[model samples]
Target: MVARDYGQYDGITQALELVGERWALLIVRDLLVGPRRYGELAAGLPRIPSNILAARLKELQAAGVIRRAPRSRIVLYELTPYGRELEPVVLAFGAWGFKALGDPRAEQIITPDSMTISLRTAFRPQVAAELPATAYGARFGGDDLLIRVQGPELAVTRGDGPADLAFASGPGIHRLISGELTPEAAIDAGVVEVLDGPRILLTRFATTFHLAA
Candidate 1:
């Protein structure tokens, strides 16, 4: 059971009662990208205690926000259709919080999932429309992601795949997205390495994402 009861008469209170638990919404955020095995969820949220993660999963599953499906021999945890409906809410929250973002501490880490979500929150479709369709492979630590921008839509998928451009480093990309560092600055500082793909694509990528002013 959840730790607190908020009376639950008003709709706002009811919703908060259902999702206000710490880490609950974060689980939803991670699953927003796609289904994940327990280990994958844990890896994406490295700081969450194992017991807490299990408990949150159980709570979300009980609330009909998530479901378990057997994939081959392993079970994957995925958001239900109802849970997927939270996309707008999550994205809105991310956008609202973008202005509050500041420099990271030395101990803080950026996970691949968070980076992908940031892209979703900060992507500029108007700017994207000015660029050609391109796929980017991003390597963050040991994780690999495929980021495809076609027309005005952007899709981010985990795992490696063929791409027109490829780059590595999480924080550097974050800096570029947040407009804290320009693409040329990041490259000059040797923070973002272009493993392959056209050099101009990097400039387009930098232009295609910007945090709210």
Candidate 2:
């Protein structure tokens, strides 16, 4: 742990002392989806130094926020139940931050975890309720994700499986969700392709979730 102490009294200060370190909450963000090996975490957080990543992992482990277990001869880091309690906190942060997001800089990149988390944070239950149950398979940045919407519930998982619709671009997905680009526009631009399933599902998928403009 870093040497700075925020004091033992206030809960907010204590919480920050545990997770306020740079890149720490982001590490938690990536892990919220599922367990990840060190390399996977490193890949998700492309900019974090290996040593810093190791240090953050150690700190989280010591705080009982995460735990390490052997998986197929490799160790996987996952959140403890106590750590999982921060889901709402992370999602709220994402929702609040969405309004500040402008176009990405040239050096910025999007990862699958980031995409998945955005979907979670921006889900609009009232809008989703109007759509029929559906699933979409999305492939972007060489990653496959399964997006499912059932009534008012929406979920995004990392994997490619049976889906009612499929798409293959990250920015296209982002644009669709943020209402920056319509589905038809994305298709016309050839930024997104429907590899399988009905085109209407793609339309519904685009309309089901939204972010604040």
**Per-residue lDDT of 51 in model 2:** 95
Clashing pairs in 2: none
- In the order shown, the candidates' Cα RMSDs to the true structure are 2.0, 2.2
10 residues in a row with least lDDT, candidate 1 = 170-179
lDDT of 1 by residue, 120-208 (tens): 98888888887889899999878898999998999998888999989987554667777677787888777788999886788888888
Candidate 2 lDDT, 91-206, residue by residue in tens: 99998887777766767777899888888887888888887788889988788999999989878888898898987875545667777878888787776888898777767877
Alpha carbon lDDT at 134, candidate 2:
87
Model 2 scores a TM of 0.88
Model 1 CA deviation exceeding 4 Å by range: none
lDDT accuracy of residue 63 in candidate 2: 88
